[model samples]
Target chain A: MNSIVPDSSFTARSIAENVQSGEWSAVEVLEGYLSQITQHESEINAFNTVLEEEARATARETDKDIAAGKTLGPLAGVPVALKDNLCTNGIRTTAGSRILENWKPPYDATVVQRLSAAGATVIGKTNMDEFAMGSSTENSAFGPTRNPHDLSCVPGGSSGGSAAAVAAGFAPISIGSDTGGSIRQPASLCGVVGVKPTYGSVSRFGLLAFASSLDQIGPFANTVRDAAIVHEVIGGHDPKDSTSISEPFPSFLDDLERGVEGLKVGIISELMGGIDGISPEVIQKTREAASVLSENGALIEEVSIPASLYCLSAYYLIAPAEASSNLSRYDGVRYGLRVSGETLAEMNINTRTEGFGDEVKRRIMLGTYALSAGYFDAYYGKALKVRRLLAENFDEVYSKYDVLLSPTSPCTAFKLGERTADPMTMYVNDVCTIPSNLVGHPAISVPFGSGNDGMPIGVQVLAPPMQEALMYRVASTLESAEK
Target chain B: MTEPISEKEVSHVAHLARLRLSHEELQLFTKQLGAVLEHAKDVEALQLDGVEPMSHPLPMENVTRKDEVHKMLDRDEILDQAPVTEDGRFQVPQILGEQP
Candidate 1:
């Protein structure tokens, strides 16, 4: 019965069309994914919680809706996983932290509500770095999510589980939040398509805040078109999120297949330098990808934004500073884990010490130090100035180019425990993708080719803010060319 | 360009963050935080004499919403997740010092 639907290549569009037309039932598709999850979940640890019975109930309801001749939304009958940071009413959302181990949100995040309204079944909550803090999923309190492509290697994080779930066919699509390359880096490592939309394009309401200014929820899919389909459904304004753009968003799928003819593409020279620890294969693959676009009528040139060399430094300071403030809500008085102590202040200190992982603690301390009375101007303040300079640098380049191109990561997936020993080495993993987050530009990672140890390499396409449609066109072009 | 973070500094920052840390954690954090700060020195090397800092990428300011009544979460449902509660209020350790 399950063989009716292909396990690995089930896309959201195909499932929705077939279910709506009665060629295949939503229950059948759900069964197919459940079986896949049962088979691969232990190996990958892609999911933190699997809502088996609830998802089955939702699938049955959708089948009835289809029978009644109701018009379905874009995501009808589709099964999607969400990064655990996004709140799901009545479901435990841990953000991969022990503090929220037993916490169930009373309300759904805007994206979750939107997905449900679109007739998509909430399959489960995927794992992540504890509070979305680490470069790899190693910081997850539940456990690390291994790369589906190679179990010994890490699925880049803090969106590793979502990316791995898509790559392993647990779900056709999943939502991930990117703050300094969480989504794109993992999507690249897992050999799937991932997007980090323009900062204000998606509502952040109900997403457990992590460096709120830099975080943006996005989708991971097996195809560029599928990603765009999910993107169109989850984007737009919400009064609940003040940072959300009030402007209307065009359908991303509308211009996705449009080729990048006569478009100006810039390959960032700063990212191409071999001195930055970028593997040779990644560099070669990115250059090859550029030539393919050039042959297809897009004019390509090398552009330099020297300030981007300092992006990681600026991000490490700025993101943690924001995170320190955002995470202060977890005092023992409210929801989440509480460890008893002699007094209120002692209890607060003990609960945090017991609940947060080492990386989370490190970031919190860094933030507190940076925002301290005497040091604010030297660290946090200076990083903000650099952030402004980085944005200006990108704006200057976007004036002459439609999109910028680079390797998604300096290298392909590294072995588990490879860079975990050194925090700085792991931080460098996001060197190529961090600038996009710093400047609030939209970016996507598409698997270009394979590199060392037969692992996949991803090439990132970045466009100016609110120019997601143009970025998708170029991404789709590269995706099709790879095929 | 800046002083390396010390055990005392890590302990002080931990206190500010309300995070209790043991001596071992303090030592480890001191080393790690020092390395991270050392790397951050790159931003200080840049010459930015009079650049305005950008706290957020979007240029919008004072995004005020109209004052209107809307649906709020049920108190019972929200209190369900609280570790300890009494009469619909969160229970916590005493904030004020004990009476002499």
Candidate 2:
């Protein structure tokens, strides 16, 4: 295991280049990661499944292709982990719920197919909050993933496992979904780079639905460039997903190193000042990040989207309202855990009662109540109106600024059970990240600096829809400053 | 807005969700749900007259595809995932109640 310590600097791009040029065989890289996973998996618990044999087989084939003078893909031979919600052919795709524990999909997700076509080796499925419903991975049925930085703290959810995998060097890059900050929040906690592309930029075909309108699959990596590399490969239109954007994918890596000089950046005023529960260290780091951009010749100013203050309330309504309908498919008949009872209705009730976790059940009830006949206009309808106002507010801000910046999470990662007792407190962890999801804008969380207790703090860069290249430019600029 | 949710209301909502909860869970949810809904009252307080509800972030309408048949998942592989299967389909409990 100690033999691969020198390879820690390999980014996804460098790994592919090395493997393609025969400087290092793909098998060697795969073995190095396997060794790291073996050494760190117990304490980190980042992976729900490990595709050791499959990865080795894929690496051997990639090496053989290189010998045959074949053209290689950009991600050729890179070992990438998938969040468990993405369907992988012949692999167990559990959304960290007991219901899908033994079920394996017969087909692959569009992103999975694309990754395979690009010559990337599937490492394994990473863990997530069951159905991606919670801010902490504590809701995962398989158990929580501990933060690699400190084992006592959480890695953030529901993409905790993917972020931890990247930070712990189990893999250079991994894929995770963001529905109201699942990817960015976890990446912030784990001290890695995570991107939530503009909704519809990445095809969502085969991503397990969790608030369909908010979900978007993206990447996690140790560097901005690596995250961009994976993002380009996984993005683009898929006819299979109706919501996928029908335009050609842009070259994200081309503008990555372009720097943020002359770029107009704004600090979201609503996210700053007199906010409860925000740590002083987080505020200082955010200010320092803004200064770094300003000193680099970028223009910075404060902008407000007052309607964003209600985004949390609106998201809690819209997301669960959508989730209640999307998750209704898990009734005891077709697939998943089926608990038998005297009658069909009783069986359906029993199966759900046993299959779902507490947070999931609570959301389902909330959604059901909100969407019920009498309360629909008061709760779900009003939330939708608020959603429009938030979107309009973002539109207004984008008219004046090229990008918006904010602290990814109000505070650094806390102990595992710190806020599990109070759901609202846990929900507040997403306050800064959820607005971007609601507006369908692209956002990335870059590791800015350390906060209290030496835990990593992330600063987010948000851009209007389809402006991922600009977002990456600013992100890479911040990333280079850190280095 | 701070009205506490009744146990009966929690039970009714759980029934609508097809979820069975213990008496303890019912009481817990009644309190928790009340707190969440109380927080949610902020949305209702706004004057949203004439505001159109935005269902999706992207402004797209009925995204229909071309009418062409495509490959589907293998039947046997799909059936293998079901907990109970009959002759080529999922087997479920009888839909009609037993004859009186």
Candidate 3:
């Protein structure tokens, strides 16, 4: 059995091919991954819940199917990890918060259902920022998921665990939710490919709503082609989730090797030279990527999005405001942990106090205040207006450019506990990403550079709503060229 | 121009939001919130003279759907999540001046 390593480049396709040809047994694959989790999970702190017996049984069944000449799906017998937020039947689906620590969903999320139907064996649930609220995994109720690249450093969250798992080879690929770049940011930091599908393309049913309008489920893989393969399986309509569109799904795998020839790539000048805290190395890498695209026959053009300056400000208001409402469902009334006191108010207070982490409480308070009667017009409503303007600006740019390019994050993974005390500083980490969420467009984060600290930094590719295949083609070309 | 918001207003909002704060938290959040209001102040300063406020991204009109019978969750499952419940209703302490 091969041990899982940080740079284990064998993808789901390669592993499946070996397993199907009887070259590698499904039992061996599961056992190998199990051994990997046992060896590395302590150092990485990636998984919050591990399903060892369940995975072993599934692997046995897969072996039986192969013996019987069963028609195996593309990812049959392949081990994949999942972010904790995606609900699994009878499994603890904690969204990295104490409130739902013991809450087991009665049904599987659409994505989970699809993955199972596609013959992928789910190994475990991974850690994330509490309620997918923070940019770092430090906010997880269980504990922070450490970066695989540097043990002492943080894993970018709220899909940090998923990214870290894929990077560290705990699993070949994992599904992660991207709301405000949760998937891609971590992918960039961990040197993996994380793609956030266009809004409303994937079903959000059973994804514990953290900003319903912006939340999307995507795959994190070591290779862009692997990510595309996983995305195609999980991308489609579901009657269970009304937000999911009944549109024809694109053949992401079929378009994996498509180059960006004659494509118009917009280099957002403001994102490149605009921010103060961004490092020179990030800018250099971005410029280099732009040049490569230009060299590859892509028409690179400088684009300015002036309203992007207010994206962070707008995000804070809108995300918190939506979070406050979404989190209201967690009040000791629904399936989760509950604390009690003599009075009703005291009971509610005690339950929330013990159940919620500091960051979740802080955001809830901020959101509640922002959406309060007198303050709604001033904060939430105004933010909505700015969000519109930003979306319109992106629309105008996309009318000309095929896709917009910028650094995925301002910087790479910082040391663990670096920004725990300073919330404002932490919020700035999502400056480039928050715009995509606000505009309800799709974006992907692919590794482009090694930061000054030698950690991975990602380049973000933004496309207009439902233009994910276009973004995927450009990203794949860049991904191929880098290799 | 943004009108000055009082600390009392913040306190009231906090109450509605169910936040239990120390004296220090209140003071700190107030000052920080006040400083951040400048952006909103600037946004309010915009000449959105004829622009109607947008609620959603898509230009959706009045959407009405037919009501259909769906299987509601079982009483046991519904009650399974409550911190405390009695007689199929969520339980809370009876308030002297409040209605259930």
Alpha-carbon RMSD, candidate 1: 2.5
User: Which is the winner by lDDT between candidate 1 and candidate 3?
Assistant: 1
Model 1 chain A poorest 10 in a row by lDDT: A1-10
Query: What would the per-residue lDDT of candidate 2 be over residues A1-483, giving only the tens digit for each residue?
Result: 111112355799999998889888999999998998999888878899999999999999999999999878998889999999999988999899998888798889999998888889999899899999887798999989888888888999999989888888889899999999999999998889999999999999989998999999999998898888888888998888989998886798887888888999999877776456667788788889999999988999999888888888899998999999998998988878999977778788888999988999999999998898878998999999998888888888899899999889988988989989888999989989999888899999999988758888999999999999899999999998987
* lDDT of prediction 1: 0.91
What TM-score does each of the candidates earn? Answer: 0.98, 0.97, 0.94
Ranking by lDDT: 1, 2, 3
Better of 1 and 3 by DockQ: 1
DockQ of each candidate relative to the true complex = 0.80, 0.75, 0.41
Q: Which candidate wins on lDDT? A: 1
Candidate number with greatest DockQ: 1
Residue ranges of candidate 2 with Cα displaced over 4 Å? A1-7, B98-100
lDDT of 1 by residue, A413-440 (tens): 9889999887899999989989998889
Query: Could you tell me how far off, in angstroms, the CA of residue A481 lies in candidate 2 after the best superposition?
Result: 0.6
Cα lDDT tens digits, model 3, A101-211, are 888887789899899888789999999999998888999989899888888788798899999998888899999998788998899988899988887778888798998
